[model samples]
Target: MQAIHKRLQALTLLIAEDDESTLKWLSRVLSIYFKEVRVAKDAMQALELFKESPSDVIISDIEMPQVDGLHLLQKISQLSPNTIRVVMTAYNTPEYINIAVESNVDFYLKKPIDIDEFLVAISSSVSKGSILSEEIFLNEDYSYSYKQKLVKKGQESIKLTKKEVLLLELLLKNRKSIVSIEQIEHSVWQESVSADAIRMVVAGIRKKLYQGVIENVKGLGYRIE
Candidate 1:
């Protein structure tokens, strides 16, 4: 555990789990390394805390009351795409694996929590954190780095979901014409989605960037001007 990078201690981490004993154990171990460790007994509380003050990383359990960890991770992905997401689970089923991939999980800490395994998982996340990359200027206000997989407005990062990133990338790729709704679904969602759902995602990107950053074609689709 001491082998873990010192840079990790500079980050804030949040852990969501319903079990009291497990919560305490994780809190005790991680609190030593992280600058701050905030624990939530349920995914809802975790969501609330994240919205209030987004953490650098989050580790959530698969089984919990009302909401599961995968769903929570999805929300986190929407709220802060750059935040490293990890799942804690006992089951290694294909179903869980698929969902975790869709939610953009970075690592998995299996149940029974070996001290070595958990430390390695955190270290992996820290390794994922730092990288030097060139930026592609998207607009006057925002720039994106493909290597870092991030969008930035000057110094502040624009919080966006993975779907939002895909949609933005699609529009930027087709900056000349309106990318039809069908195209958005195929490239971004990869499945059929309602117009309203698409609208919400577009609206979300605009909110993060600027209103005029994304232009709606009214009847067709959208594009970046």
Candidate 2:
């Protein structure tokens, strides 16, 4: 629990369960470690809260009114591709597993959830949140090392500030996809930031990486090309 607590304390989580007793129990367990835990009675409510305040991890029950877990996961994937999705349900059928996999859920936990396994899954999800890959090529001269979180061109290493590193990582994670200013503020700053502040951060990153590495989609957001 101590180890799990450390790994989850900084993360925000959402749990959707139609059963009141199960919801209360899960919320209590999750609140022990997670920084913020939001609960929803059904998938629709979960989606609403998720849109209002995106969460690092989303744990949802497969069976729910209006929108089921699989449908919710699909919507979430479109809304926030980086969010970790988990499905917890009593149904342990092959069809459910196949559907969950197709929906891109990060984890599937059968009801009567094992505490240890659930903790491990959550920890793994947190680790996966990092945009690290084998390598990401920024340009002909520069490549970003996901493991090192450094940019390199030949033998020279281009230094990046902490904020710059976060910004670059976020962009690379969503490479070629538009990342909204709101998403940038939430993921990088972890709080509300002025649009001007986000622009300044982007400006600083552009200066380091070169102007065209990041493209500003006017009125939309930013993307890495």
Candidate 3:
């Protein structure tokens, strides 16, 4: 049971619903528990918000004017797999059921959502994994020794710093793609992360890991090999 903090608060929730009334009502209800709530009038808005900064959980309706819930689910999976996703649909079709299963959504509910069920699902999801203890690894043909906290390249052992170790674990979880600097700082330091700080730490890790251990995109973030 984590209290409502910036890191664990219902801190931010992304809700995609087209109906004005329902959206307002949901925002009101969720605001009571969460410190910040962002509402998307349609799927496109939801996707944009998600891309900007992923939410702790996503609750979206199936039907929308722009993209639709199913497409949103697919995008979320491809872009941000760590987000806990839930879909709400009035149409209970076999197709949707299959999609939900394939998408591996946290839960699916009919329209006119039951708040209690939603709360239960969310609570269980939060407790399922220890966010602090996750490991993020690269897809290289390298062997990792976690207990030893070493990575072997040929006959050499690469020693990582405390920050490097934490950063590496987070990057491994987000393998093959850019991990947002925001996520890295918040999760690792439990404080605000500055670009200068991230650069210093990343440079240190790269120097130890390999010549080109981490790839830094201009506008994006870090990706490890």
User: What lDDT would candidate 3 get against the real structure?
Assistant: 0.72
Measure candidate 1: CA RMSD: 9.8
What tens digits encode model 3's per-residue C-alpha lDDT throughout 51-128? 665566788888898688878988876665667788998878889889888876878998899876786677666566
Full ranking by TM-score: 2, 3, 1
Off by over 4 Å in 1: 1-5, 130-225
Models 1 onward score TM values of 0.57, 0.68, 0.62
Top lDDT model: 2
Candidate 2: give its CA RMSD in angstroms.
5.6
Between the candidate structures 1 and 3, which one is better when assessed by lDDT? 1
- Candidates' C-alpha lDDT: 0.78, 0.82, 0.72
Cα RMSD (Å) between model 3 and the true structure?
A: 8.3
What local lDDT score does residue 12 receive in model 1, on the 0 to 100 scale? 77
Q: Is candidate 2 or candidate 3 better by lDDT?
A: 2
- Kindly report which residue stretches of model 2 are placed more than 4 angstroms away from their true locations once superposed: 128-176, 180-214, 217-220
| Model 1 poorest ten-residue lDDT run | 125-134
Order of models, best lDDT first: 2, 1, 3
